[model samples]
Target: MTVTTRLAAAALLLLSLAGCEGMSRGQQRALSGGAIGAAGGAALGALTGGSALTGALLGGAGGAAIGAITR
Candidate 1:
Protein backbone atom coordinates (compact mmCIF):
# COMPACT_ATOMS: atom_id res chain seq x y z
CA MET A 1 0.00 0.00 0.00
CA THR A 2 0.98 3.62 -0.32
CA VAL A 3 2.37 5.74 2.49
CA THR A 4 -0.88 7.65 2.78
CA THR A 5 -2.86 4.48 3.12
CA ARG A 6 -0.45 3.11 5.69
CA LEU A 7 -0.59 6.27 7.75
CA ALA A 8 -4.38 6.41 7.56
CA ALA A 9 -4.60 2.80 8.65
CA ALA A 10 -2.31 3.43 11.57
CA ALA A 11 -4.32 6.48 12.60
CA LEU A 12 -7.54 4.52 12.39
CA LEU A 13 -6.13 1.73 14.52
CA LEU A 14 -5.05 4.16 17.18
CA LEU A 15 -8.42 5.89 17.14
CA SER A 16 -10.20 2.57 17.49
CA LEU A 17 -8.16 1.74 20.55
CA ALA A 18 -8.86 5.13 21.97
CA GLY A 19 -12.57 4.68 21.37
CA CYS A 20 -12.56 1.45 23.30
CA GLU A 21 -10.82 2.94 26.25
CA GLY A 22 -13.33 4.91 28.33
CA MET A 23 -14.46 7.41 25.73
CA SER A 24 -18.14 8.32 25.69
CA ARG A 25 -20.14 6.98 22.78
CA GLY A 26 -20.67 10.36 21.18
CA GLN A 27 -17.07 11.40 21.60
CA GLN A 28 -15.82 8.10 20.26
CA ARG A 29 -18.09 8.23 17.24
CA ALA A 30 -17.16 11.81 16.47
CA LEU A 31 -13.46 11.17 16.73
CA SER A 32 -13.59 7.94 14.79
CA GLY A 33 -15.81 9.37 12.08
CA GLY A 34 -13.61 12.43 11.70
CA ALA A 35 -10.54 10.29 11.29
CA ILE A 36 -12.21 8.00 8.79
CA GLY A 37 -13.62 10.93 6.86
CA ALA A 38 -10.29 12.75 6.69
CA ALA A 39 -8.57 9.64 5.41
CA GLY A 40 -11.25 8.95 2.86
CA GLY A 41 -11.24 12.57 1.75
CA ALA A 42 -7.51 12.62 1.28
CA ALA A 43 -7.62 9.48 -0.82
CA LEU A 44 -10.53 10.68 -2.91
CA GLY A 45 -9.03 14.11 -3.29
CA ALA A 46 -5.86 12.72 -4.78
CA LEU A 47 -7.86 10.69 -7.24
CA THR A 48 -10.29 13.40 -8.30
CA GLY A 49 -8.04 16.43 -8.55
CA GLY A 50 -9.87 18.08 -5.69
CA SER A 51 -8.36 20.13 -2.92
CA ALA A 52 -7.48 18.22 0.22
CA LEU A 53 -8.79 21.06 2.36
CA THR A 54 -12.14 20.92 0.65
CA GLY A 55 -12.24 17.21 1.01
CA ALA A 56 -11.38 17.45 4.66
CA LEU A 57 -14.09 20.02 5.29
CA LEU A 58 -16.68 17.97 3.53
CA GLY A 59 -15.55 14.88 5.31
CA GLY A 60 -15.66 16.48 8.71
CA ALA A 61 -19.14 17.78 8.12
CA GLY A 62 -20.35 14.42 6.96
CA GLY A 63 -18.62 12.75 9.85
CA ALA A 64 -20.28 15.06 12.33
CA ALA A 65 -23.65 14.25 10.89
CA ILE A 66 -23.03 10.56 11.05
CA GLY A 67 -21.70 10.81 14.54
CA ALA A 68 -24.63 12.89 15.75
CA ILE A 69 -27.19 10.61 14.20
CA THR A 70 -25.63 7.45 15.55
CA ARG A 71 -26.40 8.27 19.16
Candidate 2:
Protein backbone atom coordinates (compact mmCIF):
# COMPACT_ATOMS: atom_id res chain seq x y z
CA MET A 1 0.00 0.00 0.00
CA THR A 2 1.01 3.54 -0.55
CA VAL A 3 2.15 5.77 2.32
CA THR A 4 -1.13 7.67 2.28
CA THR A 5 -3.15 4.48 2.30
CA ARG A 6 -1.17 3.05 5.18
CA LEU A 7 -1.50 6.20 7.25
CA ALA A 8 -5.22 6.37 6.61
CA ALA A 9 -5.64 2.73 7.58
CA ALA A 10 -3.67 3.25 10.77
CA ALA A 11 -5.79 6.23 11.67
CA LEU A 12 -8.98 4.30 11.05
CA LEU A 13 -7.73 1.41 13.12
CA LEU A 14 -6.89 3.65 16.07
CA LEU A 15 -10.30 5.26 15.89
CA SER A 16 -12.00 1.89 15.81
CA LEU A 17 -10.07 0.69 18.83
CA ALA A 18 -11.04 3.72 20.88
CA GLY A 19 -14.34 2.08 21.74
CA CYS A 20 -12.84 -0.97 23.42
CA GLU A 21 -12.99 0.60 26.89
CA GLY A 22 -15.64 -1.86 27.99
CA MET A 23 -13.60 -4.95 27.16
CA SER A 24 -11.98 -7.08 29.83
CA ARG A 25 -8.24 -7.06 30.45
CA GLY A 26 -7.47 -10.20 28.49
CA GLN A 27 -9.65 -9.14 25.62
CA GLN A 28 -7.96 -5.76 25.51
CA ARG A 29 -4.50 -7.29 25.55
CA ALA A 30 -5.35 -9.68 22.76
CA LEU A 31 -6.80 -6.93 20.65
CA SER A 32 -3.85 -4.66 21.26
CA GLY A 33 -1.35 -7.38 20.48
CA GLY A 34 -3.15 -8.37 17.32
CA ALA A 35 -3.24 -4.80 16.10
CA ILE A 36 0.43 -4.25 16.85
CA GLY A 37 1.39 -7.52 15.22
CA ALA A 38 -0.69 -6.90 12.14
CA ALA A 39 0.91 -3.48 11.72
CA GLY A 40 4.41 -4.87 12.13
CA GLY A 41 3.71 -7.80 9.84
CA ALA A 42 2.30 -5.56 7.17
CA ALA A 43 5.32 -3.34 7.38
CA LEU A 44 7.68 -6.29 7.17
CA GLY A 45 5.74 -7.80 4.30
CA ALA A 46 5.78 -4.55 2.41
CA LEU A 47 9.50 -4.11 2.99
CA THR A 48 10.16 -7.67 1.82
CA GLY A 49 7.80 -7.41 -1.12
CA GLY A 50 5.63 -10.23 0.20
CA SER A 51 1.87 -10.47 0.90
CA ALA A 52 0.83 -7.97 3.57
CA LEU A 53 -2.54 -9.60 4.21
CA THR A 54 -1.01 -13.00 4.82
CA GLY A 55 1.65 -11.55 7.05
CA ALA A 56 -0.94 -9.63 9.02
CA LEU A 57 -3.07 -12.75 9.49
CA LEU A 58 -0.20 -14.87 10.69
CA GLY A 59 1.18 -12.19 12.92
CA GLY A 60 -2.20 -11.32 14.35
CA ALA A 61 -2.85 -14.96 15.21
CA GLY A 62 0.49 -15.36 16.87
CA GLY A 63 0.13 -12.16 18.80
CA ALA A 64 -3.38 -13.00 19.97
CA ALA A 65 -2.24 -16.38 21.18
CA ILE A 66 0.62 -14.89 23.13
CA GLY A 67 -1.50 -12.14 24.54
CA ALA A 68 -4.23 -14.54 25.62
CA ILE A 69 -1.68 -16.68 27.40
CA THR A 70 -0.28 -13.76 29.36
CA ARG A 71 -1.58 -12.10 32.55
Candidate 3:
Protein backbone atom coordinates (compact mmCIF):
# COMPACT_ATOMS: atom_id res chain seq x y z
CA MET A 1 0.00 0.00 0.00
CA THR A 2 0.98 3.60 -0.44
CA VAL A 3 2.28 5.65 2.46
CA THR A 4 -0.87 7.75 2.54
CA THR A 5 -3.10 4.69 2.69
CA ARG A 6 -0.99 3.16 5.43
CA LEU A 7 -1.08 6.37 7.41
CA ALA A 8 -4.81 6.68 7.01
CA ALA A 9 -5.35 3.10 8.16
CA ALA A 10 -3.12 3.65 11.16
CA ALA A 11 -4.95 6.83 12.07
CA LEU A 12 -8.30 5.10 11.77
CA LEU A 13 -7.12 2.22 13.97
CA LEU A 14 -5.86 4.67 16.58
CA LEU A 15 -9.14 6.54 16.55
CA SER A 16 -11.12 3.34 16.87
CA LEU A 17 -9.03 2.26 19.83
CA ALA A 18 -9.30 5.68 21.41
CA GLY A 19 -13.08 5.52 21.30
CA CYS A 20 -13.29 2.42 23.51
CA GLU A 21 -12.39 4.12 26.77
CA GLY A 22 -15.82 4.21 28.44
CA MET A 23 -17.56 1.33 26.64
CA SER A 24 -18.51 -2.00 28.22
CA ARG A 25 -16.68 -5.16 27.18
CA GLY A 26 -19.39 -6.32 24.82
CA GLN A 27 -19.74 -2.91 23.25
CA GLN A 28 -16.02 -2.68 22.76
CA ARG A 29 -15.81 -6.09 21.17
CA ALA A 30 -18.71 -5.38 18.82
CA LEU A 31 -17.27 -2.09 17.67
CA SER A 32 -13.79 -3.53 17.31
CA GLY A 33 -15.04 -6.51 15.35
CA GLY A 34 -17.15 -4.35 13.09
CA ALA A 35 -14.28 -2.02 12.35
CA ILE A 36 -11.86 -4.83 11.67
CA GLY A 37 -14.35 -6.63 9.49
CA ALA A 38 -15.24 -3.54 7.53
CA ALA A 39 -11.59 -2.78 6.89
CA GLY A 40 -10.91 -6.30 5.75
CA GLY A 41 -13.99 -6.35 3.57
CA ALA A 42 -13.17 -3.05 1.98
CA ALA A 43 -9.68 -4.21 1.15
CA LEU A 44 -10.95 -7.44 -0.31
CA GLY A 45 -13.62 -5.67 -2.34
CA ALA A 46 -11.11 -3.25 -3.77
CA LEU A 47 -8.78 -6.04 -4.75
CA THR A 48 -11.62 -7.94 -6.41
CA GLY A 49 -13.30 -4.98 -8.16
CA GLY A 50 -16.43 -5.35 -6.05
CA SER A 51 -18.38 -2.80 -4.02
CA ALA A 52 -16.50 -1.80 -0.94
CA LEU A 53 -19.50 -0.20 0.71
CA THR A 54 -21.55 -3.33 0.23
CA GLY A 55 -18.79 -5.50 1.54
CA ALA A 56 -18.29 -3.25 4.54
CA LEU A 57 -21.98 -3.24 5.37
CA LEU A 58 -22.27 -6.99 5.13
CA GLY A 59 -19.08 -7.53 7.08
CA GLY A 60 -20.08 -5.09 9.77
CA ALA A 61 -23.42 -6.81 10.23
CA GLY A 62 -21.82 -10.24 10.40
CA GLY A 63 -19.14 -9.04 12.77
CA ALA A 64 -21.63 -7.36 15.05
CA ALA A 65 -23.75 -10.50 15.15
CA ILE A 66 -20.80 -12.73 15.94
CA GLY A 67 -19.44 -10.31 18.49
CA ALA A 68 -22.77 -10.03 20.27
CA ILE A 69 -23.27 -13.77 20.24
CA THR A 70 -19.81 -14.59 21.49
CA ARG A 71 -19.89 -12.15 24.36
Candidate 4:
Protein backbone atom coordinates (compact mmCIF):
# COMPACT_ATOMS: atom_id res chain seq x y z
CA MET A 1 0.00 0.00 0.00
CA THR A 2 1.03 3.60 -0.41
CA VAL A 3 2.07 5.71 2.56
CA THR A 4 -1.16 7.64 2.39
CA THR A 5 -3.20 4.45 2.41
CA ARG A 6 -1.28 3.09 5.37
CA LEU A 7 -1.64 6.33 7.25
CA ALA A 8 -5.36 6.40 6.56
CA ALA A 9 -5.73 2.82 7.73
CA ALA A 10 -3.84 3.58 10.91
CA ALA A 11 -5.93 6.63 11.54
CA LEU A 12 -9.15 4.68 11.02
CA LEU A 13 -7.96 1.91 13.31
CA LEU A 14 -7.17 4.38 16.05
CA LEU A 15 -10.48 6.10 15.58
CA SER A 16 -12.30 2.74 15.72
CA LEU A 17 -10.66 1.93 19.04
CA ALA A 18 -12.35 4.96 20.56
CA GLY A 19 -15.56 2.95 20.61
CA CYS A 20 -13.98 0.43 22.98
CA GLU A 21 -13.93 3.01 25.76
CA GLY A 22 -17.50 2.08 26.53
CA MET A 23 -16.74 -1.62 26.90
CA SER A 24 -15.68 -3.41 30.07
CA ARG A 25 -12.04 -4.18 30.73
CA GLY A 26 -12.52 -7.85 29.92
CA GLN A 27 -14.24 -7.14 26.65
CA GLN A 28 -11.52 -4.69 25.68
CA ARG A 29 -8.78 -7.17 26.50
CA ALA A 30 -10.51 -9.93 24.57
CA LEU A 31 -10.96 -7.70 21.56
CA SER A 32 -7.37 -6.54 21.69
CA GLY A 33 -6.06 -10.08 22.09
CA GLY A 34 -8.19 -11.36 19.22
CA ALA A 35 -7.04 -8.58 16.92
CA ILE A 36 -3.40 -9.14 17.81
CA GLY A 37 -3.70 -12.87 17.43
CA ALA A 38 -5.53 -12.61 14.12
CA ALA A 39 -2.89 -10.29 12.76
CA GLY A 40 -0.06 -12.52 13.94
CA GLY A 41 -1.77 -15.65 12.67
CA ALA A 42 -2.39 -14.14 9.25
CA ALA A 43 1.23 -13.07 8.97
CA LEU A 44 2.50 -16.44 10.09
CA GLY A 45 0.17 -18.30 7.81
CA ALA A 46 1.26 -16.20 4.86
CA LEU A 47 4.90 -16.78 5.70
CA THR A 48 4.37 -20.52 6.07
CA GLY A 49 2.17 -20.81 3.00
CA GLY A 50 -0.75 -22.11 5.02
CA SER A 51 -4.40 -21.09 5.17
CA ALA A 52 -4.60 -17.68 6.69
CA LEU A 53 -8.28 -17.99 7.50
CA THR A 54 -7.80 -21.15 9.51
CA GLY A 55 -4.82 -19.78 11.35
CA ALA A 56 -6.61 -16.58 12.15
CA LEU A 57 -9.69 -18.37 13.39
CA LEU A 58 -7.74 -20.65 15.70
CA GLY A 59 -5.44 -17.94 16.96
CA GLY A 60 -8.31 -15.53 17.53
CA ALA A 61 -10.26 -18.14 19.48
CA GLY A 62 -7.29 -19.02 21.67
CA GLY A 63 -6.35 -15.43 22.27
CA ALA A 64 -9.86 -14.41 23.18
CA ALA A 65 -10.17 -17.36 25.56
CA ILE A 66 -6.91 -16.47 27.26
CA GLY A 67 -7.79 -12.83 27.42
CA ALA A 68 -11.16 -13.54 28.97
CA ILE A 69 -9.65 -15.92 31.46
CA THR A 70 -6.86 -13.58 32.46
CA ARG A 71 -9.26 -10.75 32.99
Each candidate structure's count of clashing pairs: 0, 0, 0, 0
- After superposition, candidate 4 runs with Cα above 4 Å error: 1-7
- Per-residue CA lDDT of model 3 for 1-71, tens digit only, reads 99999999999989977878999989878887887888888888878999999888888888877776785
Model 1, span 26-56: residue lDDT tens? 8788877887887788778878998887888
TM-score to native of every candidate shown: 0.62, 0.72, 0.69, 0.79
Clashing pairs in 3: none
- The deviation in Å at residue 37 for candidate 2 is 0.6
In the range 3-68, model 4's lDDT, one tens digit per residue, is 999999999999997889899989988988888888888778888999998889888888887777
lDDT of 2: 0.88
Q: What overall lDDT goes with each candidate model?
A: 0.81, 0.88, 0.84, 0.87
Top TM-score model: 4
Determine which window of 10 residues in candidate 1 has minimal summed lDDT: 16-25
Clashing pairs in 4: none
Decreasing TM-score order of the candidates? 4, 2, 3, 1
Which prediction has the highest lDDT against the true structure? 2
**TM-score for candidate 2, residues paired by index:** 0.72
Residue 66 miss distance in model 4 (angstroms): 0.7
lDDT of 2 by residue, 1-71 (tens): 89999999999989887889789999999988888888888888888999999889888888888887799
Per-model C-alpha RMSD:
5.1, 4.7, 3.7, 2.0
